[model samples]
Target chain A: MNNWYMLTLVGNDRTGIVAKVTRILQQNNCQLGEASMLRLGGNFTIMMMVNSELSSDDIITALQAISAELNLQVHLDEIEGRLHEHHIPNVLVTVIGADRGGIIAQVTEKLFNVGFDILNLDSDVAGTDERAIYIMRIEGQALDGIESIEAALQPLKADGIDISVQAIETLIA
Target chain B: MAIHPILTYPNQQLKQVSQPVDNFDHNLRAFIDELQETMHDGPGAVGIAAPQIGHAIRLVIVDVSNKKKIKHHGHLVLVNPEIVEWQGLAVGREGCLSVPDFTGNVVRAERIKLNAFDAYGEPLSFEMEGYEARALQHEIDHLDGLLFLDRLVSRRNDLFERKKR
Candidate 1:
């Protein structure tokens, strides 16, 4: 059986974390697969699935040594395998205009209830702090059509708040 | 001859920067005709680029005049087109025939002053606003090896997987 593992590393936000972690993994003859590194709030985090020749126990000991040295929280565990992109119809939902509370909640709730799969979402509070503007882009699968999704988002629109849902073929590009 | 096959991504040719259309000959006119035919054959297509038809030349056609209510320059064959000045911003949902199956919300110049040579090799310059301006910008990007994806507001969330048309 192939040895596939999920590895997560979180520590203070600093450079060289990736270099160090990957170097260790590289020394162990581990091939990095889908990996993501994110800086959240104040700390940084790294998550990846890797295929390796080393066993789980061997990887755990190697990672623990680095964890103690770098003041990081490291977790390594065996996993089944990987997930590939599915051939599903996806939609792009963009919401802009005035910033207000409960906007994300309201929008997400409606989309979720209607079978829209939230693949990716990014939002920002721009304009000015006094006249705070909220802009968001959501990529997901809308099982229904764009018209129905638009209708679902209709109530969210006000004088300045604009919400639009349209079919997007994102994977193509 | 007739409608040519639209090249999709990874075709290498789509990314190659197009050379300027230096000559306005019979072949150029026929190529423009083929592009018009291809655009009409596409699903709600508004414009097409020469690179999309395997010709790396600065030439594109746009005809949004027939679709809905919008002031337009009618069917235009802009050769070596350039946007001299731009103003304001408009966000519109756009799809490309070459990049089929996907559409994106792109922010474009709400108004523009464009300068270009017509299909007959005559110099033409004019101002375009609203939908017409947006369409011209989208088609022009293709000549410069740019796709709507490159202009997406946010790649992570702005990109959507479209259902097959």
Candidate 2:
């Protein structure tokens, strides 16, 4: 919680974004905490939470060079609070079905309705346009109200989607 | 006197096989008490092994009895244990007290008949199935220096290595 700042960078998805940004932060001696970059459609977007003694103006000045060079958009904001989360069950959910509108929408909605938090989700489409296959993986906590989120997903079968949910016990021997 | 700091992975001690406990002495009982307390203190921990606390002994404590899906209803102090028979394969997601932040799919035996001694040196055998059996197998694996990463279904698709903590 010391001199924390949130940085968001968006640009074309190609190469070297990580390399360039990390180098800048290293030069300024700033530490990167939680960072996420995702390619949405065709643009690559990055969100990084950082903590450092360096002032925001100093970090922003360094990143500005990369922003202009890479034709990227950058934003910097400071945070003045602590971040913490209660430990909860982490489950792996897989959904596969014909690529169609609302596959991600419907599955995620049901998971949320059943009190499961969707932490991360990634989906892809393959096969063919006439019968594209969509595969997705979601990991998150299942709140107390969820009797069995897997059972609630049974209705998705009507949409040609097959889903499976399993508890992630990564540390268990 | 109860809860101890659960060791995280990459800690060399977690990889070593534990030796069987032969003494039913006061110290052994005291260690078992600490293990139970540690397991209870862990957030949602169903079972734990001796090595997890840096104690290289064949001791494990499991009590999934209170878990809603599969409840057994008591503490299990297994010492110097052996799995005589096992059947069925069940793949479930699992995380560890030592390795927090990531979770993966693990395939474990659905049922097992385990022979072991109690903390007081009394011989005991257990017939476990479903969730309880899975938890027992996981704890026993710790005694043999096995982590769930060793039996992952598929590292590529079965892992949630990216953690947000």
Candidate 3:
């Protein structure tokens, strides 16, 4: 395979969000390798794996244009060499407790600052009125493994959030 | 005498709780051998339980050397195992051979003090930590007819159909 790319899009839920994003990638000759799409609350989430012989610059420019037009947040990163041979180090992060507005942004921002690439994430508001519970399993990849992550997430302790991390092996790019 | 085919989900056989080894007969030797063989045969496979091979016996063979993370932890073969005590809770993503095509977050005990009969029928007690504990617990759960799917603490948005390579 040629170079591999991971691109993600998240924004206000709208019709044709996927088609518009994919259409741009297809124009840039990016091969869709993997994809996951979901609508949570009022937002649409799209994560895709793409392959192209072109430089990261070419793909990023195309994605940036679409993000501007659609008002979506986007991220793109390239995988290379020996690191490409190893399976993406997917980590499962589970957070269970009461629901709140800034959970995704807060958790994901932590992951992003430390170079974690989210693969699949799904959350639901569970339980009844007196005791409400929110359970979410976010699948992500961090090639550096648990040591780096453990240090990066020390602040989460203040929030009384339970954290568990497991390194996963899934597909060589 | 050889690696046995893993009885995947919907096979019905994988869901049945295994019978306890009453006498440690010749058949028990063969069952343990096959479980060890099968674990070595798969690419990243570490352990195999009796139910996973269509046998309903309280036995599981684990060798974590093949897994990079727990390679230094060495091999563990547990027969009629019991976790005497455990401390603290840790969540990990666990997958089983019987439950092919998916993995999920499972909260399991982080450290375990347990006892089991070894290959020579001698009682042995040990304390295991980290990923090793998770792997051992996962295999033992199979002996009780519980697949990793049963331990899925959360659900993904989609069914996540696996396409064989």
lDDT value for model 3: 0.71
lDDT score, candidate 1, position B2: 98
The residue-by-residue lDDT of candidate 3 on A51-113, one tens digit each, is 887788788787787788878988777863232232333676666667667777877788888
Model 3 reaches what TM-score against the true structure?
Answer: 0.56
If you assessed candidate 3 against the hidden native complex, which CAPRI class would it receive? incorrect
The stretch of ten residues in a row with the least summed lDDT in candidate 1 chain A is: A164-173
Residue A51, candidate 3: Cα error in Å is 25
lDDT of 1 by residue, B49-106 (tens): 8888889999988877765556789988899999999998755567677765556567
Ranking by DockQ: 2, 1, 3
Looking at candidate 2 chain A, the ten consecutive residues that score lowest on lDDT are A80-89
lDDT of 3 by residue, B36-114 (tens): 8887776577677888878888887766665564423477777788889888776556666666655666667878988
lDDT of 3 at A124: 81
Q: What is the TM-score of chain A in candidate 2?
A: 0.79
lDDT (C-alpha, whole model) for all candidates: 0.79, 0.78, 0.71
Q: Lowest-lDDT window of 10 residues in candidate 3 chain B?
A: B156-165
Tell me, what's the RMSD of every candidate? 6.5, 5.4, 10.3
| Residues A6-45 of candidate 1: C-alpha lDDT, one tens digit per residue | 9988999887788888899899888887777777646788
User: Mind giving the per-residue lDDT tens digits that candidate 2 earns over B79-138?
Assistant: 998899999776676778888765656877877999999989999998998778888888
Every model's DockQ? 0.10, 0.26, 0.07
State how far residue B70 of model 3 sits from its true place (Å): 5.4
